[model samples]
Target: MREAPPNAVAAHYATCTALAFSAVAVPFLPEAVLLYAGIQYLRGFLYGSRQWRAPARVPLTLGRRGYRDATTRKRGEATWPVGTADGRQVWLLRQDLAQGCAFQGDDPDWQAASIERLVFAACLNRMGAVVVQDHAAPPLAGRIAAVARPFGCDLGMAAIDLHASLTPPLHLTTSAIEAALGDLGLSEKAQELNRALSPVLRMIGTRHGLNALALYRAFLDAEALSTLSRGEYEIDGLTVNTDGPASADAAALVDLQALGEAEREEARQELAPYARELACTTGLSLTDGLDLGTAIAARRLTCIRPASPLTAVLVQALCCEALAAQEPVSGSEVLVHLGELHALSADTVRRFLTSTTAAGAIGTVALPSTPDATLMRLVSESCRIRFEHRSTGKQWHTHLISTLKDCTFSRDIEPFLVERSGKTGNI
Candidate 1:
């Protein structure tokens, strides 16, 4: 008798094995073995003696334009091309896996879910479940399975059984999968599983749910850095009351007076131009406006507890501006006042002035000195800074002096007026 072709001989043997199992109802035959027999029967019937072909390797590209699979026209809603340890290929199909699954990366639990899915796919493939949608059908399935068998040791029934024994449910959550793995002492498998799973997760699809969490974290970090860079490392000095009585601790009273005197000096020293300019602008005599502005500036500098040192300087400047009325202070005047008020180096003061000018908190002028020696002064007065209180629902002001302090200024201003309470004052 003529020898049959190798393909026919293999097919014939596979068919006999299937028939014998069917007749005896063997309990030990693996699902893949049964699938192997079915595939041989189909190949012999459909393709005859044609040699089995390797599956077409598809290149997956992820981009702004979305997912692209090189070999097939069919597109999954979400798809990923995964490589097995044995160099075999399995392209995962996206389904309702994401419907209830928390979004990847956003949810703390997603990585664990990813590991479980990888384990599930490997196990399912061993049980004759085709993990690759492209190779799920007749003619292709037979060839793919044949190619997969020799190195399918890791994808075998025993490994699959180990996973199933850990978790009984067909559907899994990240927590459930993790708990099962821990219970089964398969915790050691997690790192390898995660390494294998991460690439596939990236290859899969949409990150719609993860974007919000990422944005929030980014904003928080940026805000914190900005605060630090601005030297806002301490609590704002809140307005305190010293009117009731002297402190029981005599030392505290002395300390408070010393602090207040220091602030008063900061407010009054080197502020003559700012005071005079404001007085001339307000239709008041230069002497009267200057005197009044200096007093108010000193009072605010001494009494107002500012959130930051910068705020204290701003408040003092604002008080002087209020005295000036319609006249704006020159940049040089402000620079001089701030310079006298703070012990900061010239460079630090210049940087602060530059930043405040750019933010419109203060106005400036160009000086004629060489670039390094040149400096600017604050010219404008009557500036206001407004902000919303995120939690309190109260609108707040960070002006050189708050409206709450207007009453105190008014008392000071009365003495400077040409006429006070229908009577002539000393001014």
Candidate 2:
């Protein structure tokens, strides 16, 4: 007979010694036996010669005590075991078992189903049934399950779950607002002006249901009207003479303010065309055919606020792009892709990912196989970020709202009025 290899002999002796120790310790130290058995089983499942297989059955008992594995019963509740392919069992749970019988015989669908069941069961055991159920099948569910398998679940789920229940709107402090404004390339004077205006803007928001973008648009309109009131203003390198035809048309709108309410309503309709022409010609930014004052009067101006730095839509897009790729994506590659697509800088992207404000909407996993280099994959689909007060330990959550396509800005601002012939249109 062929002699067993040296490694096999060592393993055999190790198993025998463990079994002898377990036999002697069972009576006085039953817990030690169980622990040793579990450790050995996990070792076999992960690194032993036999392949890991699942959906194995064991008898279950539900007597006066509670549910447990029954030693002698031939028939029992279906229990799935995390074990080696050759039948060494690691872990089993009665309450969380898969809802199918053991692998009775070989069938392709059954085999596939068994693998799926194992994946689902493992994820459910780790992340709870809700997370497992939330992800869709084919790719997302499979990918999430694969992620959960090694780490035994996203450790961040507890914080995420806690925050989801009590999420609140983002409330930027004066300092936070200043920092965000600075990031947008605002001058120090501009930042101070915005800071001074924020309280009033926030009040306006509360009363009118206007968001940050709408408030910014209102400020811009006011600024533009003030410039037009001067009869001349320089923007960029161009000197705009509001005293020209565009200004005359806009000044006509000021006259409507003095008329009686009923008369003003009638005059607005008659004057709207002239206002539209003036807006098309003289407005600094593109206008929807109404000058700032006329738009304010008609309630036709609409502006959507830009998304916050860590919006869910942005994070989701990043994750989807990375996961859908045929090959693994590096951390730097992800940042570059996001920056190019969304006009975000690398520092901004990094800040969002690492910020405690992000709650735990996203997480990263390092690829172990790539020893020479590092690779990462995102691991969650949650849509909330968090904020915590350092002194009070009080927490606030911000649900990452979906962004609108039309509201998104992908390019630099364009001049509303372009000169045709020697004169600008409507001027």
Candidate 3:
């Protein structure tokens, strides 16, 4: 057996310790770290009000490529083999619930993190579900899952199951989930945590392709609209129609079409906020402009998906590329900004930037009369990349759209911002 490296071992210990203590103290979505198909397990516990236990170590099996693997008893706490009502079994792995951390150079620890994600994908394969519950957002989760696809698994969507397997399993409607969330004793505590992190989420929205501020404003707007319209209103799904005619290959309509009525309703309650807000503020209906923008954003993200370690660098760089004609800022400035956002070490950020710059994924310009002053810019607004099969010499070209011309947020997040700004004096 190959012994784990010292750094990997240390990181494992630190992560497990943090998760164990935190799960015990704060029982908010303790199973949220699960990659896919674990949402039902979470719903079961949360709705059933059962006493939840943080499994010490999940049983794992590493077998030959085609052999049936048997579970090996590992170190730490005993693993739990919790069977879902659908007859699928998932072991509560180690106490660590986090998927992966930010890049820390080309170290054994980073490899270990990648290994964990691979294991997660494998587990999802066995459990047989493609939806993931990612607080980070669907696009990012989709990207990471795409990276792990080579491990014989593919993640489909980012969502949570609204029902748990019980006797005559309860399928929750949108209002039901909302009500349950409102009354959960953990909501206040979770809110406190989210409150602390909201600013950070907003600051990196542009660079990360998430647009947190816009999403939040949309959510708030949906809530108000839902209330005012007495739950009769709906945000129709539309294709993105920007920068000339929308491509048929543009992402399919952003709809909950794949889900059952209850599932779709619940998901709509969660995601439609962002989409509807996008529509209202832009004066674009779901069928006209908003969907097109979503398609564009989704299309841009395709290029970001296949690149790892380079993911953040590419995401930030693409945003910069779209927002300006010339190098809006020096490569060093962008590097520093990314470093602060991701909390990466100077060395790791520098190396990532250096490698990508050399590969021409990122472009730089020299300032006049300034020695060694090269400002970073995007390579192009859009371009095509070719990937060739090594053995067959078969080649395919993929068109990559590096920028979204309509990546705009709500004006001051509109009505929500106005109230929060205290410009109204008092209620």
* Top lDDT hit: 2
Give lDDT per model, in order: 0.27, 0.30, 0.27
The clash count of every prediction, one per candidate, is 13, 1, 5
**Against the true structure, what is every candidate's RMSD?**
36.9, 23.4, 28.2
Error of 2 at 306 (Å): 8.8
Better of 1 and 3 by TM-score: 3
| Backbone steric clashes in candidate 3, count | 5
Residue 382's C-alpha lDDT in candidate 1?
19
Task: For residues 32-77, write the lDDT of model 1, one tens digit per residue.
Answer: 5666666666645443332221122222322223322322322222
The per-residue C-alpha lDDT of model 1 at residue 71 equals: 27
lDDT of 3: 0.27
Model 1: lDDT to the true structure: 0.27
Top model number, TM-score: 2
Candidate 1 runs further than 4 Å off: 1-78, 99-427
Which wins on lDDT, candidate 1 or candidate 2?
Answer: 2
At residue 156, candidate 3 shows an lDDT of 32
